[model samples]
Target: MAFTNEQIAVLEGAIASGILTVRYADRTVTYQSLKEMRITLRQMRGEMAAQVPGRPRARRTIRLYQSGSGNV
Candidate 1:
């Protein structure tokens, strides 16, 4: 499911407030713990970025180069 900025804001607020129970627009969710909430928040942010645009995509790259020693 796509997440809205409002939802993210709500979750962030709960985390900042150090509360586990988050009351969203029309729903109230009780997290198992602060750690879980944090994890969810991260996921939410990632998902939001993926859903929206202007977010930089992560890329993994590797370059190999060899240099001659003593003109060998």
Candidate 2:
């Protein structure tokens, strides 16, 4: 479904205000992160790229090192 200009304005407003929440057709969407918001915006604008499945999500790796390792 295509979004109207008013809806676009609301989305833009939410982005600008850093709210990241939108109410659409009696449904509320609280974006998890900026990435999710952008994806939703793209979809609302009829962009197919964001609609594709298997889109790799950003991943962060952390190193866990033990000092003076002991079998405990």
Candidate 3:
């Protein structure tokens, strides 16, 4: 997710010339400038990562039924 200074400069040029755009399945986004694009990309990446499945829940120690009885 990190970009070198040279790469950033190149992207900045492309953005200034309207060559770079953010595209999703349903729509496209045009950034005002490279700085905005970088910010937007970072936010999008965070959102995508957050949507990924997380670790399973830990097992519970307490049981509802004990010694075949209905109540604890």
Candidate 4:
């Protein structure tokens, strides 16, 4: 699906406000700020839900890890 300019702007703003983080190189990198990753993900999920019919929607939650966290 294509996002409009306005929608993109809103997403960008959310990212800037610390609502989402795009990860790369095994490190968390915020699109706008450290805390915005969650917010952006929420917004994106909402947008996706609205555009896609008959799909299950899920709520957003935070998962925290201490230093030296490892994947199973």
Candidate maximizing lDDT: 1
Model 2: residue 43 alpha-carbon error in angstroms? 2.1
Model 4 global lDDT (CA atoms, 0 to 1): 0.57
lDDT of 3 at 42: 62
Superposed on all Cα atoms, the candidates' RMSDs to the truth, in angstroms, are: 5.6, 7.4, 13.0, 13.8
Better of 2 and 4 by lDDT: 2
* Per-residue C-alpha lDDT of model 4 across residues 37-66, encoded as one tens digit per residue: 556556656776677888766768999878
Per-residue lDDT over 1-72 for candidate 2, one digit per residue giving the tens place of the 0 to 100 score: 546666767787888888978886688888898788877776676533335578755468999888785777
Residue 59 Cα positional deviation in candidate 2, in Å, after optimal superposition: 30
Candidate 1, residue 38: Cα displacement in angstroms equals 0.6
**Tens digits of per-residue lDDT for model 3 on 1-72?**
433444445545556676767444455656676678778556555554555688444456965654665676
lDDT score at residue 59, model 2, on the 0-100 scale: 67
Off by over 4 Å in 2: 47-72
TM-score of each: 0.72, 0.51, 0.40, 0.31
The models' CA-based lDDT, in order, is 0.88, 0.72, 0.57, 0.57
Task: Rank all candidate structures by their lDDT, best first, as comma-separated numbers.
Answer: 1, 2, 4, 3
Candidate 2 lands at a TM-score of: 0.51
User: What is the model-wide C-alpha lDDT for candidate 2?
Assistant: 0.72
RMSD of 4: 13.8
